[model samples]
Structures are given as structure tokens and as C-alpha cells.
Target chain A: AQTVTQSQPEMSVQEAETVTLSCTYDTSESDYYLFWYKQPPSRQMILVIRQEAYKQQNATENRFSVNFQKAAKSFSLKISDSQLGDAAMYFCAYRSGIGGSNFGNEKLTFGTGTRLTIIP
Target chain B: EPEVTQTPSHQVTQMGQEVILRCVPISNHLYFYWYRQILGQKVEFLVSFYNNEISEKSEIFDDQFSVERPDGSNFTLKIRSTKLEDSAMYFCASKGGAGRNQPQHFGDGTRLSIL
Candidate 1:
């Protein structure tokens, strides 16, 4: 069984600043993927960024990036130049590689979520 | 860009009533999935469907939850009996059927409100 944990229940960042949301996961599998998803007030789940366990270098998407430390089992999301629109709940998820099984490969185990707030 | 679409942006139903949430996956997608997010909570995986059969489902998707691909385009989630706990935003997702990110495309979601 795999589990993800986001210790921060809530975090606030000033407009145009940066904030890093922490995440930790437990999985015995070697090949896997990590993802950060953001859900706004509209309740729409949006993919922020993703990182593969095999890739030592973290993943970056525009202003969103991930600090993935495979050995430490830690994957954190960093949002730079945060805007008001970034205010939402952010989740950390994990998925196994392909050829596994249905709930096998792509099934995502999500963390509790961190409510991100951007203050102007 | 091709994306998933879900119907009934918002649904109001009473407890014990049956409700079906509809989704139209991308034309080329072969993998479909259903997830839900309760108010102020993380998104939870409900079920996954592929090759016209249920590939996987979570413990939360018990007897009350069912999924069907009635046709080439529509994938639906039917709840036998709605409950207050069932109130949440139901999301439909699809992927290209290959790759690592497999980047699941998500629909805006159908807000299910059980009264």
C-alpha cells in the first residue's frame, strides 16, 4: 500500500512572492511518478507539475516546480511569483509506472492537501 | 486542445434517489476514470475503466457506485442511492493511453449535491 502526506494544512504567501508546499510519500515500488494538483474555488482539479522517480532533476512548469528527493521520499511543490489566482487547495499525488495494473499503474494516492492562500 | 467534458454542472438530488453523472471523454482516449472531491478535501479516486470493463475501483466505490460506457463517447457513473456524504464535485478524466505523465485530462466536474 502507498500513502502520501502533506503536513501543512494551510499556507499563505504574499502576492508576487514564492511559497513551497511540502509533501512526503511512502511507497516500496522503485518506478513511480509524483504529481502536484491544484483545486481552485471552482473545484476544478488542475495539474500543476509532475516528476518521475527516475529523473533526479525536478520538474518545472512555468511558475510551478517540484523538488523531488527520491531517497528522502519527499516531493514538494514550489509556486513562484504567486498570484491571487493561485489561492486554492494543493495536493500531492503518487502513481506507479505503466504495465502494472489498472489501479496498478496510474492510480493516484493523494495527500490530505494544503490550502494555499495568496494575500495581496 | 481536446479535453474531457462532464454534464449537469450542478445536480440536486434527495437521499435514496438514483443519480448518474455523465462524461464525454476525449475522442482518442481509451482510459477513463472517475474521481471526487468533497468540500475542503483532497481529490479521491473512485474508479477506473478501460477496454469497456472496470479495471479498478477504490474501497469508497462500494455497492452504491457503478460505472458504464453506454456508447463510444459517454462514460457514466451511477449511484444506486445517493447519500449526504455523496455530495461532492465528481470529476471525469481520460488519458492518451501511453506515456509516463499520461497527463490525465480532467473535466470541469459535476457538482453532486445530495439533500
Candidate 2:
């Protein structure tokens, strides 16, 4: 079984500033994927970015990036030049990479979530 | 960009009644999945469908729950007997490409309210 933990229940950042949301996971599998999702007021879950365990290089998508420390089981999300639109509920999720089973494919274990507030 | 779409947007049902949530995955997608999130809880996987059959399901997907791809485009999840605890936001997702590396795209989700 795998579990994702988002220690920060809430985070706030001033407009145009930067913010980091922390996440950790416990997984015995060596190969897996980590993801960050954003749920705006519309409640639609949107993929922010993803990182593969095998890749030592952190993933970056525009303003969203991740600090992935595989040895520490930590994958934190960083939002640079944060905007008001970044205000939303953020979730950290883990998915196994073992093939031939749905457990490794479609199923994802998600953290409770971190509410991000962007202050003007 | 292609995206998954769900129907009804919201559903209200009485306890013990039947409720069906529908989704239309991306046209080229080879995998389908169902997940639910209680108001204040983490999202949980319910089931995954491929090749016209269920590939895997979670413990939460008991006998009372069923999934179907009745047509070329429609994927549906039916709860035989709705309970108050079944009230949540049900999301439908689709994954393309090969293996488990592909990122799954999620729909807007249907809010199921069981009274």
C-alpha cells in the first residue's frame, strides 16, 4: 500500500511572490510517478506537473516546478511568480509504475490537499 | 486539446435508490477510470475499465457498484443502492499512450447527493 501526505493544510503567498507546498509519500515500489494537481473554485482537477522517480532531474512546467528528493520520499511543489489564479486546493498524488495491472496504471493515491491562497 | 467529459454535472437521489453517473472519455483513449472524493477527503479510486471489461476495482467498489461502456463513447457507473455515504463528487478519467506512464486526464465530475 502507498500513502501520500501533504503536511501543510494551508499556504498563502502574496501576488507575484513564490510559494512552496510540501508533500511526502511512503511507497515500497522503486518505480513510480508523482503528480501535483490543482482544483480551482470550479472544482475541476487540473494536472500541474509530474515527476518520475527514476529521473533525478526535477520537473518544471512554466511557473510550476517540483523539488523531488527520492531518498527522502519528498516531492514538493514550487509556484514562482504566483498569481491570484493560483489560488486553489492543491493535491499531491502517487501512482505505481509496475505494468500489467491497473494498480500501477489508473489508480492514484492522493493526499488530503493544501489550500493555496494568493493575496493581492 | 481533447478532454474527458461527464454528464448531469449533479445528481440527487434518495437512499436505497439507484444512481448512474456517466462519462465520455477521449476518443482515442484506451483506458477509463472512476474515482470519488468526499467533501473533505482525499480522492479515492473506484474502478478502471479497458477492453470492454473492468481491469481493476477498489474495495469501495462493492457489488452494489457497476461500470459499463454501453456505446462507443459512453462510460457509466451505476450504484445499485445509494447510501448517504455515497454522496460525493464522482470523477471519470481517461489515459492514453502506452503503459502506466501516461498521465490520466480527469473530467469535471458529477456531484452525487444522496438524501
Candidate 3:
């Protein structure tokens, strides 16, 4: 069984500042995928970025980047130059590889969440 | 770029009533999926469909729940008898690049409200 944990229940950042949301997971599989999803008040779950366990390189998408420490089982999201639009509930998720059955593929083990608030 | 789309942005129904949430996946996608998000909770995967059949489903997707791709463009989730707990945002997603390893694209989601 896989489990994801988001220690921070809430986070806030001033405009143009940066904020980091923490996440950790428990998985026996050596290969897997880690993802960060954002759910604004609109209620849509949007993918922020993703990182593969085998790849040592951290994933970065514009203002969103991840500090992935595989050995520590830690994958944290960093939002740089944060904007008010970044205010949302962020979740960390894990998925097993396609070739292997995983616990299940489409099923994502998600961290409770870290509600991000952007202050003007 | 293609995107997944779901129908009835919001659905309000009475308990024990049957409700079906629908989605239209990207034209070239192969794997389809359904996930739900209870208010103020994490998004949960319900089932995954591939090759016209269900490849995997979570324990949450019990007998009361069913999924179908009735025709070419539609994938539907039918909850036989809705419960108060079933009220949540239902999301449909699709992934394909000639393989199952592709990153999934999700729909806006249908807000199911049971009162």
C-alpha cells in the first residue's frame, strides 16, 4: 500500500514572493511518478507539475518547480513569483508505472492537501 | 491541444436516485478514468477503463457504481442508487500516447449534490 502525506495544512505567500509546500510518501516500488495538483475554488483539479522517481532531475514548469529528494521520500513544490491566482488547495499524488500493475495505475494516493493563500 | 470534457457541470438529486455523469475524452486517447473529490477532501480514483472494459477500480467503486463508453465519444459513470456520501465532484480523465504510461488530461468535473 502507498500513502502520501502533506504536513502543512495551510500556507500563505505575498505577491511576488515564494512559497514551498511539503509532501512525503511511502511506497515499496522503486519506480513511480509524483505529481502536484491544484484545486482552486472553482473545484477543478489541475496538474501543476510531475516528477519521475528514476530521474534525478527535478521538474520545473515556469513558476512551479519541485525539490525532489528520492532518498528522503520527499517531494516538495515551490511556487516562485507567486500570484494571487496561485491561491488554491494543493495536493500531492503518486502513481505506479504502466508496465507493472502497481497497487493500481489510475488510482492516485493523495496527500490530504495544503491550502495555499496568496496575499496581496 | 485536446482536452477532456464532462457534462452537467452540476447535478442535484435526491438520495437513492440514479445519476449518470458523462465525459468526452480526447479523440486519440486510449485509457479513460473517473475520480471523485468530496468537498474539502482529496481527489479519489474510482475506476479506469481501457479497451472498452474496466482495467481497474477502487474499493470505493462498489456494485452501486458502474462505468460505460456507450458510443465513440462518451464515457459515463452511473451510480445505481446515490447516497449522501456520493455528493462530490466527479472528474473524468483520459491518457494515451500509444501506451498507458501517458499523463492523463482531466475534465472540469461534475459537482454531484445529493439532498
Could you estimate the TM-score for every candidate? 0.94, 0.97, 0.94
Candidate 1 chain B, which ten residues in sequence have the lowest lDDT sum? B96-105
* Native RMSD of candidate 2 (Å): 1.2
Off by over 4 Å in 2: none
Model 1 spans > 4 angstroms off: A103-105
After superposing candidate 3 on the true structure, give the runs of residues whose Cα lies further than 4 Å from its correct spot: A98-105, B98-101
DockQ of each: 0.55, 0.64, 0.46
Which ten-residue region of model 3 chain A has the weakest summed lDDT? A97-106
Q: Please tell me which predicted candidate would have the highest lDDT against the true structure.
A: 2
Q: How well is candidate 3 docked (DockQ)?
A: 0.46
Question: What does the lDDT read for residue A42 in candidate 3?
Answer: 80
Ranking by DockQ: 2, 1, 3
**Residue A60 displacement in candidate 3 (angstroms):** 1.2
Model 3 lDDT, residue A33, Cα: 91
